[model samples]
Target chain A: MTVPGTLYGVGLGPGDPDLITRRAARLIEGARVVAYPALAGGDSFARAIAANMIPATAREIVMEVPMTPARAPAQAAYDAGAARIAEALDAGDDVVVLCEGDPFFYGSFMYLHARLAPLFAVEVVPGVTSVTACAARAGLPLAARNETLTVLPGPLPDAELRARIREADTLVLMKVGRHLSRLRALLDAEGLLDRAVYVERATLPVERRLPLAEAPDPAPYFSMILVTKGADPWL
Target chain B: MTVPGTLYGVGLGPGDPDLITRRAARLIEGARVVAYPALAGGDSFARAIAANMIPATAREIVMEVPMTPARAPAQAAYDAGAARIAEALDAGDDVVVLCEGDPFFYGSFMYLHARLAPLFAVEVVPGVTSVTACAARAGLPLAARNETLTVLPGPLPDAELRARIREADTLVLMKVGRHLSRLRALLDAEGLLDRAVYVERATLPVERRLPLAEAPDPAPYFSMILVTKGADPWL
Candidate 1:
């Protein structure tokens, strides 16, 4: 008999169907229910990447997770979302929560997991992080021997931003959407502006890479900057 | 007609057959010639992975790569390996050089790539990194949001190692073979020894993880340590 109240947090990988791990694919395909967070009615990247692995007859639940910044409001939204996921687990169904990239790497799925892991069985399947994805897409090494790799979110204070860039051989600046211009100035002051490569939606259908100095605002949160020594390999 | 004198660096994705990316699988399955790095006499994880992706009829070339501390000898080994790959591409055959993890992530495949990419046509397909694979196997997040993730080689000077341990939220110590004991002492001094997880032969058939205190010298070069909260998730 199948175990009840079980949850599988599957990593859909970096927006490619084939990149899904064999174990993740199996859990997803055999799942009695599958849930993925969505911004709206449109298809989510996580869902699309995991589209192939999901079986035809499984129960598909597109959970609408609200993006709220406030503590109380966000907690309410998370509670409601967790309730929906719990409903499936309570029904004795094996539910697979599909997440883009790794589930724990700044991903929103952690909320649902934190609420449920203590009361139920939970397993997280790791996927490729965007740092590795973009580095590979750019045909460059993330870090060489004796090199330090640091991943800093773009919203950090100017001091933190400058410190991270100056402290490592390689730095991946995530959340570069609205802060591209500020980061560009920071990199310029640090003398790393010339070597930085801005990659947006790396490994996705609309993936693009350009020099960070020329990158204007309007990039997405899925974007990142891979700054390393050496010229762009594609050039 | 296929272009002559073009090379492809394909990511083998850890050591599992199923972890190979779909793009990598298509390229390998379609390639006229497949090449992979081997220590000697042909047995290699990269080749075994690519072999599972392609049909039985595909041609194979095993490039011998000898890792040496001397710069001159290593360069010669890379030069010879690149030359062997050039032969297949010269015949108007699509050649795929399979590499473990992402091609540019600390693997010897990058050496061959550096030699051939300038003079020949080249394409690189990034796959799942071993860090990600090992993280998946352990079911732990490598680093969370706002967490400092530092990947060091474990042979760093004592002061540098101590500083890294003090500042990072999540630290991954790679290339840890016989230096395990010294590392354990350092972590103990930093009060992180109990929390450290040591993994050997990550994602391979005999992969195993031990508490930092119990690790003997059975681990190899490819092994790693996932130190949770190496960097504080939140400041």
Candidate 2:
């Protein structure tokens, strides 16, 4: 039984229902109301991932989160939505906010959590993050001991990017769709492009992988670039 | 849909069969053989997580990694395991090794990868590392945007530990069950002992969470401590 005055921030796992942790599933199934963020497009893939697990009788609330890269107006929109969640908790309605990965790992759920959690008791139900799921799908390890693994968002300064690439033995560059060509070049400049792999919508049923040179249409914004210094250690 | 020369390394999500990513599941189901490292106890948790996913008739190879703190014997055992895998691939079988969490995070997979990868096609699948999962399970975010997050194993010089705690906004101390008292003292010195959370077997069915003080028999290993400096942003 849940203690009073509590909110659960649940992880949906990366766009796959079966990937939800059993704990997350139980929480959602029994939650008084299951909350999720959506855009004008409606129920997001991440939301759908966990929706199947929540019983049909449970209330599903789609609090919109601006999907476009956040600028002034977008941030304003997120603020407004977070306010809606706050209003819910005032009525003693417990919420289970569905996030794509571990709610905090580069997912949009943080915004909602930030806004709603302050006045309410909050507990995070961690789910598998996409990086792990991607690596799992790729059948690759994140790093070897003392091998140094680096996680670089696509927007870092090129020098920072290069230094991370030079320093780490394994690198998982996230949000690289827009920066694919630039990242590809960086890898090539470092002579490691041939060792890179592209994973698009990893762990999703529609997932696919390819050599860095052969990836189709440079992946969606959800794509990542995984590079290794030596060879696949498990080979 | 077989790729002639490529080998896939799939990481099963830590200890939970249902937590395995859909793509990891797909690959395992399709692979001709599945391999996993076993310790003294047989039918490893990693293997158990992948069991339902693999083909019913697929070959299962077990590489026994020693269970000890020693180095050389462990290294040699990994070398032998790598040799056996090499023999399998030499026979033209595509092998998928099930690692509990991203194999490279901390495991024998890295040793085997180093030994066999250069000579054969290989891939590393990442799994839910204990840190991210533990942090999430504990209802804490690892770090905010600019806050430094340090990942440290126990047994570091006290000086290094102090420096890490001083620099990082979020500290994930791994291998701490045995070293609990030392960690407790360090956090106490930093005035964070009460705020610290001990997470054991995070995301698994039997996962447990308690304040550092509640750990009656501090486990010295696999347990993680998440120390957060920011006002609970998601609280």
lDDT (Cα, tens digit) per residue for candidate 2, span A1-235 = 4334567787777666766665677777787777776776675766678756777776777766555544555567667766766666666777788787777766666766777666688887666777766765665666544343456677667887786577555677887777788888898999988889899888677887888888765558778888867434532
| Candidate number achieving the greatest lDDT relative to the actual structure | 1
lDDT of 2: 0.70
* Standalone chain B TM-score for every prediction: 0.90, 0.90
Point out where model 1 deviates above 4 Å: A40-43, A230-235, B230-235
Per-residue lDDT of model 2, residues B49-138, tens digit only: 777777888888887767676766667767776777777788888788887776767655766666777788887655556777776666
Clashes of each: 8, 19
Residue B133 shift from truth in candidate 2, angstroms: 1.9
Q: Write one digit per residue (lDDT tens) for candidate 1, span A28-136.
A: 8788788888864555778888877778898887766555544555556567767878888887877898989877777767767778877788877766667777877
Give Cα-based local distance difference scores for all models. Answer: 0.75, 0.70
How far in Å is the alpha carbon of A182 misplaced in model 2? Answer: 2.5
